[model samples]
Target: MSYSWSTEEYSNHYSTDFDTIEECIKEAKDMGCKAGTTIWIGKVEEVDIRRVNLTSILEDLHNAVYDDVGEFAEDWYIEDIDSKEAYEKCENAINDLVVKYIEENGMKPTFAKVVDAELYVIK
Candidate 1:
């Protein structure tokens, strides 16, 4: 097979216009496609646990970094995060956890942002 597919969605529960970090993660953790795992199972054949966590963290980072602290962000993780310090907080959180996953896995961080991006395609 030379092709595959996946789906991504904005965490609507937190995102009035865009998904907040907490909401993105919460939804991914609960996705039916996650195969009962509390996170998105990115690929069915070989699931990447790190990407799963990123799905959650990235949304939060986008919201906190963008400065749109809209109402309705009163979710579990969101509530814990003080909006004033969210930028550094979320950044550090993802970097500490998800980024480490990629590093340990030998997967370069930038690969996710670009198509056909992989440290090496294991055939």
Candidate 2:
């Protein structure tokens, strides 16, 4: 596992293997990263495929499917069997797409993120 950081324009990018969150933060500060700069810490994935923004996909799904349901609405519950089924279907769809992508492009390391100084897995 590794960690990396990129600023708004991806300036002064820093990547290191097994760097603590404090260390990363210190580096970012030393490098003059702005206050709101996003410090992404994760492992490096080696893959032949182009990067796909899974976060965007998930966000789009949320806005389209889950955003409209109110708290007290009939569709608000996710623990229900129907909801669970739908969730599973969505999950399967994502898995299928990812698998197909990997099949076409070859395997690579999964995306990385930081979790309290620890490397977080994306897949």
Candidate 3:
């Protein structure tokens, strides 16, 4: 797939400081944000789903997604599925998990995409 912008929306559950290499690397394992890998189009994704605290909210969403990043590492590798399939699956999984988390916390997913994995601004 050409990564066409679909109807799939975003909701920033939370944000953390992954600006540094170490931070990015650590977050890649701890929170799933990568340092160089462009997951979306530019920089990491940012939505509008708010919580009591940014850091804590992100941690909560991280917890709700999987037991931990280790368990989901294989899924992130994308060796099992093709490139396009991987993106679609990632989108579906993220949307499903993120949407569920927001709804459960009594919030709506209505944020914007700040950046993709490559750290580019689509907006």
Candidate 4:
């Protein structure tokens, strides 16, 4: 059967004939669909999307890294630094870690931004 797909935002459209339903569905997803926009599909039976709680995962990772850094800072043998200096250093380290994660995952979360020497992405 033939299938057609289009997006409402950019009005991007595509149509093609496929031998199987799976093929048609795959092609529809591959076609450009603007983020956070609905896609109109012709003759689509069902759709399945894998979901993950990214915020929870990120929070856990951030906390773990922050705790590790804090512990390292507190150890006198690691560095002879006072509380204020250690706090500032840990903050910078956390920002760098978050920024690197964002880049590696190709995530464009709204909160992610760069200012001066620090890369901030929430927290």
- Can you write out model 1's per-residue Cα lDDT over 6-104, one digit (the tens) per residue? 232221122111133344344444443353333211211233343334345656765775566654443535424446466666556766787587778
C-alpha positional error of residue 29 in candidate 1 after TM-score superposition, expressed in Å = 52
Candidate 1 residue 14 Cα shift, in angstroms, is 39
Which tens-of-lDDT digit does each residue in 1-123 have in candidate 3?
112121122424423434443444444445444444432222335455432333354455656565655577434432333566665666566667777887898776444454433332221
Off by over 4 Å in 4: 1-82, 110-123
- Candidate 1 weakest lDDT stretch, 10 residues: 114-123
Q: What TM-score does prediction 1 earn?
A: 0.23
| RMSD each, Å | 19.1, 12.2, 19.3, 17.0
Residue 85 alpha-carbon offset, candidate 1, angstroms: 1.4
Worst 10 residues of 4 by lDDT: 114-123
lDDT (Cα atoms) of all candidates against the true structure? 0.39, 0.52, 0.43, 0.45
lDDT: which candidate is best?
2
Residue 87, candidate 1: alpha-carbon lDDT: 60
- lDDT of candidate 4? 0.45
> Can you list the residue pairs that collide in candidate 1?
21-59, 21-60, 25-56
lDDT of candidate 2 over 1-120, digit per residue (tens): 455654422333436544455666677677776666666654443433444444466566555565576443444333334566676677667767887877778664554433333332
